[model samples]
Target chain A: MSQPQPTVLILEDNPGDFFLVKEFLKRTSLPAYEIHHTERVADAIKLLQEQEFHLILMDLFLPDSEGIQTFMKIYPLAKQAPVIVLTGLVDEEVTLGTLQQGAQDYLIKGEYDEKLLEKTIRYSVERKHNQELIMRSEEVSRKKLEALVQERTRELEEAIKKEKLLVDLKNQFVAIASHEFRTPLSTIRFAAEYLHDYLEKIDEAEIRSKLKKIEKQVTHMTALLEDVIMAGRTDLKKILVVKSKIELRNLVDKIIEDVQNSTRNTHQIELNYNVNSKEIDTDEKLFRNIFINLLTNAIKYSPGKESVLLNIKEETGLLIITVTDQGIGISEEDQVKLFEAFQRGTNAASIAGTGLGLSIVKKAVELLKGSIRLQSGLNEGTTVEVRLPVATTENKPA
Target chain B: MTTRILLIEDTEDLGENIRDVLRMEGFNVVWARNGKIGLDTYHEITPDLIVTDIIMPLMNGLEVVREVRAFEKQTGVSPIPIIILSAKATPEDHAEGLAAGANIYLKKPCSIDNLMNAVRSLIAN
Candidate 1:
């Protein structure tokens, strides 16, 4: 009713032996088969390469290969097919050797009747199929294990790299912080030494001047520590943006006054604004931090230069602000890394700054739904521009 | 003769303080606030001894030492004992300072008395 399940191969050189096998098969009650008869081992190898066979009836004595080794040549090629050796009476021991080398069973040339031959072929096919299934499953498991090992190795490599980076970052932080700590400590120590060396001979003016130096150094150190803490808060993801209504012109004016009071830098900060009363819903703390950072940068950079220009425009519910300094600007290479945390400009190494100012400004601006850009070049000057959408009660920052 | 010392540091207050202590300890000290100015002072004064800070604008301390070495090689001047008084505190930093041709390396926040002792020993030799 359907196609035969087993396609049997016969590799016998003798015609009488081949005829006896055909006669035995013809008398069997088994299903009809597509049998291929090859008298040469070479021809059997070619047939096995060309197509898959279910069962092989092989003779150890072939046209080109003889004895137990004759089965070895065809066995590798016809591994998909189960083999049964057909042997004469004198070669019974050699036929058993063939069975040991992956052949299923053997049939005596003149002695096997129809029922015994059918039983041998049926059981050989079953055993060979089970062996192939076991091999396929083992091959699959080996490949799966290799892939899993590769994936785990990659993950561990990534984790190790991250750990190394974190350690390097910690060392870098300690180095920078130690420098900051020393400057102020040196200042206080100097003041103490001056007083200790000349306590009786020094007048009130000298005492007042040294005390003022100590106070100023302490203030500077406090500001630096606060910046470090702010950077830590950003690293910890602890900054919360809460919206409050603020007047834009007053805020700028107030920040400018505070910078003037705190800094001894004599650079005149000019605010170019006509609007005095434009109110918007924004986070006041974030806004204050951003504006003050920009103003400090402007005043600090424009050291020999006279004026810092802060141009502000409030139009169409958008605030565009630009702060320009005619100070020593950043290089083209350093500008790309300027907004990254703990990165400083090449020209600012001698300047008393912790390199956290711009990064904090960047994060605060992002939280305020704003964008910041810098136009700077070496010895040319720097201009930092910022844009923020004036959100209403309905429109807000995330 | 008063031993003249050239001091290089970036921070204005710290430089003044260190100079004050050295001047009080009977050394004629000339101070410069940055590396470029300090290098110029070295060329101009050719002081008996030199003290410097490492992290400075323009030239930095190691660059100053290297340039001074080159200058001494060109002119064949007597080698000056150089001391690195810096904020960087690490054994590796100290080793680098020595390798850069400095005779002494002292980390910052050092007491005035300790600094005076170092200056006295170096200047006396």
Candidate 2:
């Protein structure tokens, strides 16, 4: 491969000094130096801008400019070129100023020799190549650092947004709970007052029935409120699960009874408990919430007169509870997002809820090593099947 | 026949309302503001039915259910039906209450009719 020649740009107003540099560089034994000579500062500036030279021979006093000002003007343009000043008029102050403005070496033109010029040209070219390498590396490092800073800034912004969203959600929950609680509590209050005001004059059986209804409602309202609070606590990771041996059949029966009594929509629940009289070791508290959420969803979604079915069986070392509801079913698209936090189905929007029921159910089920699958479409009814490992094996870490 | 009920609740308004309603129904009702007081009164009176709310100031409803169950286990006394009244009526809450030895759990926003049905059914069972 042909080697590239070292290019030297000479900026000297004196033709005698320019000829001396060219003659010295040409006769030198070093690699061929491509000499570019310019006698005026403007032509030098134009030459520096057009081509990249390895070395520049600068004269302190030029025809158009003088001193540090000329060096300052041309130094920026000679970014990759190493500068050597060749001036006949030399003083300590001028020498210091030239060297400070990036001149590699200074020589008095009257004292210039062929040997000295060749050595200066070779040394300045090598030094310029090394400086270029360092500047290139610094530019790369600067770009990488800027990119890293931008990435970290984006991550921090997202975290702050999430935190703000959580705060807003909590505030909304508090407001909704407070507002909702008043209506139920007021009903209980009015019922109690009616019973108390006409206690003596009211028919004994009628008064007793009204009071019984009032008592039941107050209890119901209290339970619902407590559930909302507990759901919040679970979301905050404050609720603890207490594990024990629980009869599956009895658990299903209890859930059926609660759902039947809670919602008076006349939705009958059919239970199919195929598992033998075997008690499974699990956290009953967590299980109850899962069942309650599932059963409530079944009743709420099923058409008023339709029946809700519960099928419980053991398979593959797991206890499976499948709840089927014949109410307004979930669309295919909604099924994908059903278990995510704050995700509500389009059809279920008109129904009263905090949109946390399914999310809480999924969390509780996962805690119990249970997997839930839904089968449904709009108006097709829904069947939610949950499979949970009977004994959470202590041998394996969760 | 006037049936006596023991109510365990933490909130003053809820407790008063429950007490007044039961009294209106011509059934004798005793109110305990917290689970501890309810447990004490349950042992003292042994009412026909026990209605309690979970999440109280001291000795929550879950503890009260456990206490009542322990008392029944020690003595061969007739099992008193305990109903849990709570606002936290997630299926998990129902399972928890039942696991804690509650006979039944009713969620809030429940109708008076449903509550009465639950009370009557539990009493019958």
Candidate 3:
């Protein structure tokens, strides 16, 4: 059998009035109203806080809280509940004011019967459910809107990445094209200028020498075109690794030698071999490329610098190499993007490069099962450290 | 007998200069405007060594290398030593050319010395 019950909280400070309301609720043929009565406003507030009741019967006068102030405290909370005011003889005028402040209904204690009590309970419960329905719909709509906002944010991020890629490709193309053009122009310019002077003085031998210079320039342009095409293929993810064992110290020596010949502003390149006892198993050609790229970057960005250091060491079976350049330091903003493809630091704009060097270094290092990190600040110079697995003597047994 | 050489390039002036330079180096040169025609000419005379540009319409240098590799696999014949002439000179691009079965990948606007050295190495190897 279903329990015939509508639980109602009765809040009246005066004991006589509280008993009177309870007795009237009992006599009322309001089905089975389980009347839970509280004598003080504090008890009523406590009962409401603990659980949800079907309805609240509030009186205008309470020992602790009075009249409208009593209902105001309970009114907001009573919205969570259906509050029907139970007024006394002198407060008939006050009961009308309670209804104006969102109370479900008002009734004089002496005059009310079971019919009035049952009707008020039914109407108050229905009104509370309607307000809850509106609130629930609002909450659902807010969650859906938040989810849509998150999805749009992801799409915008992807679009920004695509735009960045396009810009980098265009920059790479322009740098490569200009370099190619300049090589031939330089060669022709030199050859023509020389020929103008040596055309009569040195005869055919000198002219042939000038021709050779021109030939060299033409070759330079062709190589530039090849680099641009190769870079495009790399962007397309068409490159693969050809692994081989490499001697790290020997490779560094070769790179240092190459850099010395290439750059005019000489910086003392100190190669400190802290990992002299170690060799690494990696693609030899790729190792050469890594060192070449690092050395090139160090040289390019450090124009007119006094000194740079290349420190190599072994720690925990790892071959660590540190290249520190005393030239122009990377700005704080550019440092974050230093290893990213086609990103050049603000201090490096005047330096000549396709901005592909460090990216290549990173990729090559990764293929070697190694890692690289950069440290730099504006005017404070820059240091790039690379760590790889060290090939011990046991690995290279004869 | 003039040694006939095939030059495949998208850029005309660069192609002309390369043809002239190689001619002065005592080789008869035939210029194919792009990689598609360059591959067609490969069957005609089977030129001594092919220098092909990487980016071109219809077919690119990498495709040409793949085709040559396929032909070599079927015929059991020694494949032509193809050198990739490209402006994309990243190390990854070099690796890509090698993976595609080219003998060498040379960046565009190479020094004359580098070009000669590469040609000499391929011939000697």
Clashes of each: 0, 32, 35
What candidate 3 gets wrong by more than 4 Å, as runs, is A1-31, A34-146, A161-165, A168-242, A257-270, A274-278, A301-308, A325-337, A340-351, A366-369, A373-382, A391-398, B1-125
DockQ of 3: 0.02
Query: Global lDDT of each model?
Result: 0.83, 0.76, 0.72
| Full candidate order by TM-score, most accurate first | 1, 2, 3
Better of 1 and 3 by lDDT: 1
| lDDT score for residue A176 of model 2 | 49
| lDDT score, candidate 1, position B11 | 76
Least well predicted 10-residue stretch by lDDT in candidate 1 chain A: A389-398
Candidate 3 chain B, run of 10 with poorest lDDT: B11-20
Name the best candidate (by TM-score): 1
Rank ordering of all candidates by lDDT, starting from the highest: 1, 2, 3
C-alpha RMSD by candidate, in order: 6.3, 15.4, 19.2
lDDT of 2 by residue, A324-380 (tens): 987788988988878754566887633445566787788788777779888997887
Instruction: Give candidate 1 misplaced runs (Cα > 4 Å).
Output: A1-7, A14-17, A23-33, A49-54, A61-68, A85-101, A104-141, A195-219, A222-248, A273-286, A313-319, A366-370, A387-398, B1-110, B114-125
For each candidate, give its TM-score against the true structure: 0.69, 0.62, 0.43
